[model samples]
Target: MNIRNDQYTIILLLLFFPSLGISQVEFFGYMETEYDWMEVKESTYAFGYNKLRLDYESFPAEEVSIRGNINFQTYHGQTIWEAFDFLPFDSLNINGEAVHSMPISFLDSIYMDNLYINAAFPRFDVTLGRQPISLGTGYAWNPLDIFNQKELVDPTYEQPGVHAVRLEYYINEKCIVDFILSPDTNFTQPSGMIQVKSNVASFDYSVNVARKNHLYPFWEDEDTVSTHRETSFIGGSFTGEISEYGMWGEALWSLSSNNSAGDVSYGLDHTFNNGLYVMLEGYHNSLGAEKDGLYDFHYLNYFSGETKSLMQNYLFSLLSKQINEYVSCSVFIFGNLDDNSFMYAPQLSWEILQDVSLSAFTAFSSGDADSEFGIQNQSFRVRMRAYF
Candidate 1:
């Protein structure tokens, strides 16, 4: 382990030592690799990336719990700087004669520093610290959500971490209530956001209201840009599912006041009896305007810059078959409705041992926007995962 890894390990031990007497401990992690041979540039599919995480969960007492997580990523070339601006240095060079240099930035720290605490009561459960929160169910397009993912929506983890409190209560055998409250600042704002969700009869619904306070820095000046209400979104969602085919559909709407912006979305998901799963989702966000000019939906700003929104659409299909107790094969396809781009992945997975599995996967994408494929993008990745 390096100095950074060792330091974090020590911290983890110290934090959880006091509760070890009655606590339960668990470990988990996974590894993924991608070979990108579909770039239009000189870059090969070998952007070389790997991520590892160590998680510690302790249930010291029946009502209280604690969890800690550390995530590590190693990437080569522009993939690290371009895709994620977490690092301050523009580039990294490793040569035979030069010492290694690294960038220091706030986001760089977030890459590995994450923690949380959970407390459970008879009627409600509460969690405090940095965690993920997603309000709407629209995969690539969550108009009602100020947070969301893009591209392969089903496979993308779009939500950013927030310091918040979450509450869940079992209203009855068929009903439950869920809510969240978070502090928002330039680094973290949103004095608080709350949602009330309930499931009754054959339908489920939720209503949420929230405000976000943000600051945008001029890319070059650390102190030049003024801090203002970057954006605030308030929204609600409604969903329905049928018992027979287990098909479900949902609609979401978010009203924004800062710039007179708002968005709407609709989605449907279904699973067939033959181990086939399919989903379709769409969204329209009124973030741009025009006269004879054209207005466009921009999912990138409200959520994150990583997302690109137009007449966005997403489709997910998965078919899995179990060859035996520990082996299976799955075929998945993800496509964008507004664009002619899609990814097809067929994977065969096997259990290497308890809590350990190996998988061989091949994927290819077709679309002009995706650099992984040509006019039609193509790439392959294989992953190994272990969990407990």
Candidate 2:
């Protein structure tokens, strides 16, 4: 069998027989159903999906542990016409005949999101396999996170894990260090990083250095081509509190063979005595475009892994209030200061029952036609989640 099939089979066996030969095991996860309405120009699209996730962890020995997570999702809604636009010509043909039809709404998939093993030593810890890694003080833009790219628009959302091996060591009560290595399919190309963390007084600080391959699109001979180049990055972040207010900042510098880019982010947050919280943040990206229309294409090519904007400057603000023990509401605003475009998102969440939550959110954008948030007029979403 192929490697993919083998991986699935192993996950299935683990799920069915989690307690076999294991000293201790734990299983937990959540199920979620969501409905979304999106407006692109004058066209409106309605979509929905149901997702179920299961997480398992076992400790077979004092020093050895294993963890795995599986996710299953089924999607239903309007036909995905935009997918056909990007499909290759060969993909549209079957048995020497061109398939001109697309499925309206019928797809389901199951996959393993995390499969990892951990070992604890006297002075250090080691983890190998697919896992989640994030490092930075920036709430919206995490330039220092070299392993997993995050969705800046919704910073609290969970991101997909990456395959890598990580090693962590504690030097003292306030000092720690980490090393990570991730090998690509080619095996010859590997990406990795080293980080040092420490705490002094009331401030937490971290420094990171990494080398990774970056893919960029370039125009050559009237055609767009993608090229991979090795880039070196060094970054640092710090978080501290001034009186009753929290403050944080992060900066990263990337050096390439021909060019260099830098990004910096800073933020301040405070919570009132009445349970009201507010945050304000600013980010500057040296690699982003200074003008608006130069990066208009990003609107059409936006995805989860990419940055939300290609403009240089951004301002983000958030306000949240807790109504009671089980209900909360928040509003967030992301503005492209360079282009004078902005997006506002408001959300409400409630815990209606034990282990169950309901949330509703909507996003509205306004600006010129070619501006960042103006491409998609508005969007609404409602989700229900149950954890066990």
Candidate 3:
């Protein structure tokens, strides 16, 4: 066996063998199948993925516990077409003879190699190895995460970063403060930071500030250097239930030594007596007059791509109803006041068996600039899932 596999097996045995004399070991996991298709304005593609996760949590002491999670994925067919031809190839030739060979890129191999480890103690947690960092009101941009994942909602959002150490101190039942520290390494620079979060009856808030000690090269443009680019983000959100309806609103402002941006968003979700539910959401990035610096709204960072300009106004709505105990249907539509790019989604789901389900999802997009999966979005997918 390989070194890593040997280590994993050892850890698994240690976790269960020690509990044999006292208690039984606990096992947990989930399975999911997701199929997605993209029909852009000028192009289209289809892909699907399945994954499984196994984990164990054991307690040797009342206040102390060790937990581990291992996950893997099985991918189906994949393909991509380039708009312009760059690599010319008649055939794989060896010594001037034709031969068959497959081409691959960094991304093509990443799905097969994803692993992580996290251990927690009283009021503290430390995660070592590769992982993903997701936090804050900025759904698309996570300034607080140094090891930010390239895709906002990418199921494989896990990225390589330094060992993350975090601590939480409870001030009371409604408030708690936490801090996270991670040292820069080969993949990232030495970085450290802290944040404080509070919760009230119907409101939640957080303040985060951090520093990336060294001037780093910008990811969007490798040649450009982001020197002494001290950055800070302030964000908060409020959510409450009113007369059987759910409502929430959030705002985020990003401030850096060289740029500033703001965002305001609100949403309402309600369920009817007939087992039907509806949701309404709206957002305004800025006045649209102009800002001192660029504000990106893509899944990743602004540098990666231009932010979606909703023409100062954008609204989205969704309706869903349960057809029966084992089936359901839903539709989602989002548009702007100016008829810019729009989006539509129709979905159907069915329960295959206990703890297992299957679903189909389709989408269409058109208009002015919207989110990344803009107005030119369309796709179909089938999925199966199980949990324990």
Off by over 4 Å in 2: 1-21, 79-106, 215-226, 293-308
Candidate 2: residue 155 lDDT (0-100) = 88
Q: Evaluated with TM-score, which candidate comes out highest? A: 2
Clashing pairs in 2: none
Q: Give candidate 3's error at residue 259 in angstroms.
A: 1.9
Which sequence of candidate numbers ranks them by TM-score, best first? 2, 1, 3
lDDT of 3 by residue, 134-246 (tens): 55443333333444533422213344333456566666666656666666545355555566777666656566656444322254346665533444546555667778888
Candidate 2 weakest ten by summed lDDT: 82-91
In candidate 3, list every pair of residues with a backbone clash.
184-189, 184-190, 340-367, 340-368, 341-366, 341-367, 341-368, 365-375, 366-375
After superposition, candidate 3 runs with Cα above 4 Å error: 1-25, 81-163, 182-195, 207-228, 242-244, 284-315, 335-339, 368-377
Best of the two (1, 2) by TM-score: 2
Residue-pair clashes per candidate, as listed? Answer: 10, 0, 9
Clashes of 1: 10
